[model samples]
Target chain A: MSDGRDVRACLGVCDDAADDPQHRCHPQHVGLRRVGARPGGDRTRGRAGRLLQASGRVVGGVSVSIDQRLVELGIELPTTPAPAGAYVPAVVSGNLVFTAGQLPFVGGVLPATGKVGEGDGLVDPAEAKAFAATAALNALAAIEAELGSLDRVTRVVKVNGFVASDPSFVGQPGVINGASEFLHDVFGEIGVHARAAVGVAVLPLDSPVEVELVVEFE
Target chain B: MSDGRDVRACLGVCDDAADDPQHRCHPQHVGLRRVGARPGGDRTRGRAGRLLQASGRVVGGVSVSIDQRLVELGIELPTTPAPAGAYVPAVVSGNLVFTAGQLPFVGGVLPATGKVGEGDGLVDPAEAKAFAATAALNALAAIEAELGSLDRVTRVVKVNGFVASDPSFVGQPGVINGASEFLHDVFGEIGVHARAAVGVAVLPLDSPVEVELVVEFE
Candidate 1:
């Protein structure tokens, strides 16, 4: 049903396509200005602006456009999930892994939202930890779906933990501890890696916490 | 020529040796904070502190005491050159390449330091660009020295450019353009990839700018 023009335009935006040199040279213009005005000044608006800016600036290369290749292989990018508050979408490096941010999606949609270690009536720390564990499980499932196997993982190098905090909730580390513990239980020594624990005002849909992992493969 | 005690102490810090997880987890507590307070005041201090805290804390994985396997093979991690100004060390991903921050070092020491666009009085943009290109070349050299081949590269994904700036420097993009242009010239389309142009207050030892790359390889 598509015309030649549509195919060419798609190729132009595709990650796997040969990109123009001018386009490849500049892929993102991320700077402090994008971080935006602090404290409840519409975080989604800022995030959208930044994401558009990043996505708008094209970087051309074989792998720089990996997503396009996936499409060529008839794959589709999953929708950006509601990060159970407090984390990043992905991190990149050469010949390595960048993880998409994760969230607790019950029945493919966000169902739980609250602050850990706070008097949030919706979720307790233990329950929140369990939810984080579930979110991590979801993240791994997503990775497996893309890469086809967990066997390629060489190391789970870094974890970024985001906890939807209630200012007084000082146990963000402990809440995310469940994720670390689960990774070790799954991958043993390889899962033991570096991490960062972060506190955020609110996550997408006010989910309690979100976690992402960087998995290295051989 | 070292005393028995010094040798013993050195051996103790080696990976898979007798190491106290707690002690190594607090490098700053042991006064080994290599990057510290710059003239930027609290923000810089906070960033440094966070970086230090996170760097030492090993959440899992048989402890971070596992040194690079290359050491057992008798290979040494080269003294990586510091960024010329504000920037990060590296970004990582899955089964490919992520580069550590790289600066130009001659015989393992910094021989040049300054902004890329002005203030240090470099005349032509080509000269400045060429120098940045050399720094990227040095970065690849470090990667080769560590990983053993450029052929393993699947693709170059992103190059983060950090330029030491003069207030009048609007050519930040142009100066770093040298690195991008040269990388493509060196590796063809595979070398051409995504990039970010960043300006910072200062870099380590005042080098013109620092270049880092993300490469994908088989």
Candidate 2:
């Protein structure tokens, strides 16, 4: 049933329903709308299109406003962080925004360093989990800067969590839960996403945790 | 310019242009079409939408079909490999398809093992490059299984290359080029993508190289 015409038609239906506050188009339609909304001449248009198109599916029945949820949780997105390398902090392709791997930096400096699950003189997994949350916040900040507001986001598509770990560390998923939990708290159901938690030899700047996000925006 | 009305208008334009062989809609619109074309209520719709959306950004003006390129290169997609863990080989959400980390397994067995940059007794970096390519092929096989054909794909959005490296190894990017080069040869410009080359402490199954893909398809 997947063919070009059907998707377009579905999106058209979604467009017609746009005025109704309770109307929920499919996530794919929302993604298509996001992609089509951007100016076509922008160099980032292609990338934005590709990202958003893939993120078209929206979980139905979620009416909670993301902004209100953040406020309820007393969360404030931080200022966007400067890139640690030559890359831009995030790029909008089609309907999706992909962020660079963010380090657990608080105000331009890493709060802690070394491998997770290591003994003394290294980062504890618990601490690394908190760091992961910080890194996720940084990623959200980058998204906010790119899209002008977090409310534009439709879904958190994917999260790639890279944990620098001691040789024996096997709790990479647990460490990344810090970021996942925080996202869930902020976006509720829309914050739910696919993820990869990997243990790495080291990370840039020796940071214990790094987090990146693929977010779908409306 | 990225507002719901603008996006809807853009997609409408794309739908009107669909019958023209040379017509190219904005990537997001194309992605939306792909997602909408899929049969509704299919369990994989969301995943399919996610995978296909990121792939909407086709390299415009390249007339060579992906199938033609594969034939020119004498490439044959191998059988889909079974996942080694609890995860499925690939998952489609929205218009995007994501593959689990794929190992260089031939007939369900790894061709080589050990770290990428280690001395003798371990897989050589050069050999690991080849393994990376093999792993990439496995990822493609999974995509093909999910989408039924590689032709449905529009772009290779992002590739994450994980190399199990010796402590002193520093050529992770070079090693991953094996997979990148092979993908480019097969998909040409559409295969060009953002990538991360990482050095890891170890990988599942002790394989020298592991590759995962985030692909967009129609």
What are the candidates' individual DockQ scores? Answer: 0.01, 0.07
Per-candidate TM equals 0.36, 0.55
The top-ranked prediction according to TM-score is 2
lDDT (C-alpha) at residue B57 in model 2: 31
The prediction achieving the highest DockQ against the true structure is 2
**What TM value does the first chain of each candidate achieve?**
0.57, 0.70
Assess each prediction's global lDDT (C-alpha) against the native. 0.46, 0.64
What is the lDDT, from 0 to 100, of the residue B55 in candidate 2?
31
Model 1 stretches with alpha carbons more than 4 Å out: A1-218, B1-95, B119-127
Task: List model 2 lDDT by residue over A1-218, tens digit each.
Answer: 22222333343334433222123333224212211111121224343333333223322444555565445445566677889889999999988899999997777889888888757776887677778878998999899999998889877777878888776665665577677656755664455455566778889989999999888887
The recovered share of true contacts, given per candidate in order, is 0.01, 0.08
* Per-residue lDDT of A176 in model 1: 60
Q: Model 2's DockQ?
A: 0.07
Instruction: Give the per-residue Cα lDDT of candidate 2 at B160.
Output: 94
Model 1 residue A110 CA deviation in Å: 27
Give lDDT tens digits, candidate 1, residues A68-111: 42222232334445444475444445535667778866556765
